[model samples]
Target: MISINDLTFLIGSRALYDEANWHIKPGDRVGLIGANGTGKSTLLKIIVGEYAPTSGTVSMSKDLKIGYLNQDLLSYDSHLPILNVAMEAFERQNQLQKEIDELLKQMETDYSDDILQKLSNKQEEFSALDGYNIEYKTNEVLAGLGFSTEDQLRPLNTFSGGWRMRVMLAKILLQDPDILLLDEPTNHMDLPSIKWLETYLQSFEGAIVIVSHDRYFLDKIVNRIVESRKGKLTSYAGNYSFYLEEKALRSEIQRGEFKNQQAKIKQEERLIERFKAKASKAKMAQSRIKALDKLERVEDVDDDNPTVNFSFKFTKTSGRHVVRLENVTKSYPNVDILDNAEATIEKGDKIALIGANGKGKSTLLRIIAGTETFKGKVETGHNVTTTFFAQHQLESLHLDNSILEELQAFAPKHSDTELRSLLGCFLFTGDDVFKKIRVLSGGEKSRVALAKSLTTDSNFLILDEPTNHLDIQSVNILIQALQQYEGTFISVSHDRYFLDSVANKIWFIEEEKIKEYPGTYAEFEVWNSKRVIPPSKSIPVVPTKKEEKKPVNTNADNKQQLKKLNQDLSKLESLIEELEKAIKEKEAEMADPEIFNNQDKLSLINNAYISDKSALEKAQQDWETLAEEIMNLEA
Candidate 1:
């Protein structure tokens, strides 16, 4: 739907993109990825028309509607409730509703056919636009994005910046434009919210071009990957995994080609040098020199992509039971966040705390860390020193201090050289360490906070969303470092890939209870899938005496049950696929200028499209439930 033609953008003397050309077609889900400072966001801005490219044209269909969610937080009316803010996306629907209300009031006095006809027409328009479902859809999205019904009614100003960002995200999703330009949409979302977004986007008809550091999110949603590097755009035809494999292969090939070319050039140079001094070989030498001058040099690829490399050094070993909580109860004025919650952390357990927002995952972490009071027995084992990294810890940094100073304050015993080296691991190098904390960007400050946390010699770490602002590389570095560390940690993270790599145990919190699942994140997913539809709590079926007298056909019954389940699963899958196809067909029809111009046809197709999408989502859930049941039965 949008075409970037030979686009070039310059930031001061640095070229962000040079002669970059890309085409985004309808239903294309592209994940824009690259290292930090590689202009991914800038490219998105150019596409969204927020910033004009230095050269070339970004052309789009004149009727195409684009929704751009930038990384920066939006400034909205703080007094307005979050639900109201989200509903603002359907401004036309809101206006029509207002008009309808006024028309109803007028009808009470005039009772005229003209007024009734006007109201009827407006109501039809609203129904055609699915205006009646606006509140339902809005609430659904808000809930999926981690807003409780009560929270929805709370004023927007009551939420933190991160939560406000989520409200903005809900608004954009509600808008449902033809194209989405999302930059780090999952930055503020928790695990459940991210999963909800993944499911939502999977059925979204519009084209999606996202720039996110969350690899798991990209893998789940994006069909194509585009890397912005060195002012050049490279396209990968698959998800992040494919991109990694392909990039490694390409890099290796490039490195070999470069080496071979360098060897040939050196050989030619040597031949010319040796033969140049001889009068008999002067012509040959001159020819060789000209060839050398005309030869194109292969640029060497640098392996150094700036990675953090630090490991936690535990000051002392903790007892076998590092932390223990019993009958933990934390409450607010009228709400109980946690009641009768119990959990245990071993000496070397790497636990991932996961749950929906407001489920008290962070509160549990704080309670265990002794930062928050609870009406329960919370005990830390002997020598269990703790290093806590809160979600907002970066925001609470000493602004006046430099990055170097911040780390120094935490690790005063370390030498200046050692401190600088540690900072370098976190991507703060040389003069970057001298940069004032107040001057750093959110991501930079996050890095500094992480650096400070890593400097601590603690046996246990309580981290809440530590990967929120770190780039993909930094996250990977952290994964590697954590893999090597012997210290135990309980981290609350939404990045599935990161959790899969780092977490050895899963603490799933639901209804104030922490259920422990002993496995990696991937294994936890498999286990969770099987249990999504719990086994029946009712009594088992008992055959009557007459039935028992006959040949017991248990095997036959089992086979029949399995066959029927398989058939149902297949039917649901087929129905979902058909619905998706219908939705896509309707979307393509809506994009057609002829169909778009025809108001009656547009309304019909739009309503059908919405219905098809809704059906597809339902069918998918049914398919999943059946599939899970089948798997359980077979096992």
Candidate 2:
């Protein structure tokens, strides 16, 4: 167990954490959540003892062991194969065994008391650490993380940055420290690998604190949520979904408290004002004034929402068929990644590609974008303009160029005013637009790349891990824009919530094959659940007590109710459209040039504008409610 008491950290004069307290029990599984730069990573470092806190104490049991995994990795030598390097985690165990072997040989040769005693103690320590099963367990973890048998001999240098991180993760898991401090452990992992990690962590005999933006992963793995905000810490019980609901409830309670305090202060002030105006009640007025002076004001809590935003609107539409691949095969020198994989992309299709790490998801994206070659038929649609955003697309930007120059290069024909306005849409202000590309942070670089992509007229977009460094607000904006887009999109991303919001189809790459499903993400989950379960070929299976008590639904009755609701929504949409058209016509008449010159005409137009806007907003809200009902009915 670890305890963080009165912890405070500062960057120059800015306080990142102030007098915050948090503790991790023996079986705690915590998901750390906060906006960018709120010190989630810093807290992890403090817990791991990598950084000394500016103030306060981090107390832990003596002889405690802790492991930390960072996003950036140091170079791992590839001279030895990947498996050999990963197996180094058991070095101590291996050393103990080697000594044990020598001790046994010496015991047979010379019967010295000291040598005999040493051999016995060495064997005992080795057995205590499960030294006999170290190799098997290490290999198991490596394979679970998606390393092929043949890849075990491949040099560590041959692996890419993502694969190197996977190797690091395997080593950390093999170490099995008393506490695991992971910052974005799922960032580079694919679906299968992520699931494997979740299973491993769920059974791990240690406390874990994970800082990640992946909602699905948190929902599956974490049992508690710790939010770092406004230099303070707030704890919530249960998983990410439970945290969301609990945080909302807490905010509601705080809002009610704030309102009540404000009302009380106002009432007291009114009474004091009336008494002060009368000479007869001057003493009472003085007493009331003193009470008012001593009264404590209620400070409203700050809004915790992050202000990250993105607006990506394409200017054209692609052909009916955007891309098609048949009989695709990809392999490295020692291993085959994809075997006879085939996929297709049609216009207006929001597709999400998923699979385990090293399962050819990225390889397939590269093949489609024509960056990597494959033995396959890749036919791009006619008049198709493709915009490919790779995982490290931000690094591909010219560092020498200023942010403004980078946008200008992408859209040279646009005037300065137009370019500046476009930059503003991506959250770049006046001076930020002038900053050098090399000077910006990773999050800023990602935003720049996104803004650059939006300036083009491409109708076909292929993105790989596009939301890596983005905050939640930016993700929402991007999701909204993609929903409004009229072109084709094929993305490989680990952000489950983003995929659920934008993707309409699921393309799974598994077992060296590609599988496609037509429906929303929730529908895909249901299908996947069924597919993963093996059919019963046994003699018999008795029903559980809980299952026997549950009532089976009548499908016929549900279908009739859904059909009726859909019909009603169709009628409401038509009525709202007619009212919107009438309002638009009335507003256009008041905007005439002669009327604009008259003050009275301007006043009339302004009043009409407000009324029309209010009506439109109300109608939109109603339509949204009906749309949700229709979605539920369809589901």
Candidate 3:
């Protein structure tokens, strides 16, 4: 539906994209992936005609409708309720409705058949455009995005910045434009809201071009990855994981080519040097010298790997029992914010606290971090070290201090050089390090907060919505870095992919109660699925591939086979649940004290349990095999 041909963009003297050729077909769900400052958002703006390219052309179908969601726009305000804001997408339909209403009113005075016929025709057109379902669709999207029924009637001013973004999303979805250009669409969405978006996008009719940092979302939704690097566009026919794997392979190949070119250039120079020293081989020497001069030197591309590699060396050891909240209760008149809540953060625990907005998720984080006091016990671990990063952590930084100076103040032990190096990882390069903290953008401020957090040698990290304002690549790098750190962390993040990556346990905060689920994201998904449907009906069928092995080919058959394998893998997930149940039952039987007391009974139960456990292990391994196959299919 849209095409970008030989597109070039320049910011001052620096090139953002040069001869970048790309296009979106009618139903293409392409994900624009790149590191921060790589012009993903800029490209989207160019496509939507918000900004003109320095050269080349961006063309689209004459009647193509484009819906572009910029990261941060001017806040919308009106006396109408939130629902009305969404309903604006269907303005044509609304106009038709207004005409019908007027027609009905005039029916008492003018009994003309022609007027009634026109009214009937307009009503039909409106109905065909799904005008009747406008209210229902508006409510569906709002509720899916975590807006309460009462919230639908509330004015836009009543909502926070994040909530305002949700309102924007609802309107965009309602528009159903031909091409959807989303910039960090999931930045403010909670897990459930993100899931809703995933499903919505999956079934979306028109083309989708998204620039998001959520890996899981990209992996699940996007079929293609378009990367912006070194003022060029590179396309990969797969998801985010495939892009990573292929990019690594391409990097290795480039490194090899670069080395070979350097070797050849040196070899030519050596021949020239030898010939210059001898009279007999003067002609050959001059030829070699000319060849060396004529050699077009390869411009080596710098490997832009911005991975934060920092470790916290705790100054003091914390007791086994960290911060403990016993019967902690907080209320504001009629509303019970936190009702008799109890939670604990032990040593070396990585916890993810999540809940809907206005559900006290941040309030609880504050109460635990000792930023706010509660009615009950807020016992701290013995000699415990804690560092809390609230959502507004950037605002907490000293505005007068430069980026480097701010880091130095918070992390006094680090030298100027060390502080600059740390800031560089967060993309604060050259004079950016010298910029005053107050002058930085929202994204820059977020990076500063992250840099400052790493400076502390605290064993426990308490972060609230740390992923906010960060692009997808930054979030993934942060997730990867945090996963390796040996520290107890309690983070409140709306990024589901981030939580899935780093968190080993989930602390779901709902109805003023904390529920702990001990498992990875996949396991949690299985448990959640069971809660929705009956065990018998939930059985997933695993289909075995017809062939023992398949040859590597880029033929249509290969694609079809991959699709079939993915379908089969989806079917086989139910077997995992069955095996899990058996394993649990066996463990329970082996745990019985009476069975342990009798030698014969103990042996029988132990043997049966061990056999069952082994079988379960094999099934789990097979499931992994199927999962990898599905991953390849996606790739």
Candidate 4:
């Protein structure tokens, strides 16, 4: 419905878009993706006519209606009831209703044929406009966006900015515009609300352009991916996952073509140099030189995937029992958060605390951090130093201090050089480290806060929505950092990709208690949706008459089986010992100066070592199985 033709936009001296063309046709579910400051949101605004392109046209029909949900909409304030606010989207229906009500009032007093005819006409128009069902549709959208029945009657101004944005989202959804431009819609949404929005968008007839860092949401909603990169819009005819694989393949092809072109250019350069001096070949050389000069060089792909290589500063290891909560009870004025809940956090556990909003996920994090009041026994294990990172803590950052200075103050033991190196892993390097915290953006501040949290000499970490306000790349960096962390942690986040990447266990609050699923977020999602009983649970089967007549074990048979188990265990133990010894000997050879110097010999020895290690593991497993069987027989 919208055509961006040769679009070029400039922010001062920077070209945000250069000859970028994208046609957002009807029913096109386009995911607009890019790193922060790449102008994805700006492109949406240009398409919606809020901003004009510097060089080209964003063409669409005059009849085409566009609904844009953006950060700027958070400034919208109203004292009107939320339902009324949302119902405003049905302007024609509401207007028709007003006329119908006026005609009804007139007919009550006059009851003439003219008045009756007018009333009938107005009622027909109102019915045709679906005025009677507008409120129902509005209420459904509001509820899907997480408004309770009572909340529908509440004033819009009473809601927080995030919730207000949701109200705006409900309004836009009620409009049923020809196209929807959503910029980070999931940022203000909880997982459930996000899911509801996803389902709603799936059946929506109009086109959608979503700029989101939530890869899971993008993968579920977008049928096409339009990546904003290097001042151009590149189209991918698939979702986010497909775009990733396709991009990698294209990058590889581009890399090869670039190398081949470079080699060809070098050959042409040599030929020109060799023949330019000869009178017979000078014309051909000149022609070749002109062709080379006019050649359009392929821009090299800058595929820099920065990873978090910095380590968490550890003063001491936490005990096996990181934290224990016994009979914990926490409540607000009218809401009971957790009542008599018990949970344990053990060392080396990476737990993701997740659920719908107002479920006390953050409150539980604070209770663990010992920063909130509750009726419970919360015991911190020995040497379990904790570092808590939350979005609210971002405000605790010293605005006057530079990014480097903030880190220096938080980690006084570390030198400025070490702090700068740590910040480099968070993507702050050189002059960026000197930027004052006040001048930093939300994402920048989040990176600094995360860097500070990681550098604290604490073995137990508590993070509340740490992935909030961070882009995909920053989230990936955090994921890498958490994956490498050896200590215990409980993080509250709605970012499914982050949770799946960093969490080994999932925790969700249910029935005023903390419930845990010992699996990744993706695994939990599958089991949760299916309510699948794990394979570990035994299914009892009644024995048939034929099965009931099976032979029973006698003393002699049991003794013979026990003896055989013991003999097999002993043999397996001996084999395991021998394999271990052989592996050590191979490793010793690998470490030798002679073998290490010879790559071929080292490869052979390493392969042998790996084989021995695998055999040792199998032998050990067999020994354990045999020993268990022997013990069972004796019992």
> What's the count of clashing pairs in each model shown?
1, 3, 6, 0
Question: Estimated TM-score per prediction?
Answer: 0.82, 0.74, 0.80, 0.81
* TM-score quality measure for candidate 3: 0.80
TM-score, model 4 to reference: 0.81
Which has the greatest lDDT?
4
- Candidate 2 lDDT by residue in tens digits, 451-481: 6776666888888888777756566656766
Taken over the whole model, the C-alpha lDDT of each candidate is: 0.83, 0.77, 0.78, 0.84
Which lDDT value does model 1 have at 507?
Answer: 95
Best by TM-score: 1
Candidate 2 segments exceeding 4 Å error: 72-92, 101-113, 263-313, 326-342, 404-434, 510-514, 532-635
| TM value for model 1 | 0.82
RMSD (Cα, Å) of model 2: 24.0
Task: Give the per-residue lDDT of model 4 (tens digit) for 480-588.
Answer: 8888898889998879999999999999888788899999999999888744221211121111111122288779877766676666667777777788889779867
Using lDDT, rank the candidates from best to worst: 4, 1, 3, 2
Residue 13, candidate 4: Cα error in Å is 1.6
Q: Is candidate 1 or candidate 2 better by TM-score?
A: 1
Ordered from best to worst TM-score, the candidate numbers read 1, 4, 3, 2
Tens digits of per-residue lDDT for model 3 on 346-432?
887888887666667788888988888679878888978888887577778899999988888888776777777667777788999
lDDT, residue 259, candidate 1:
98
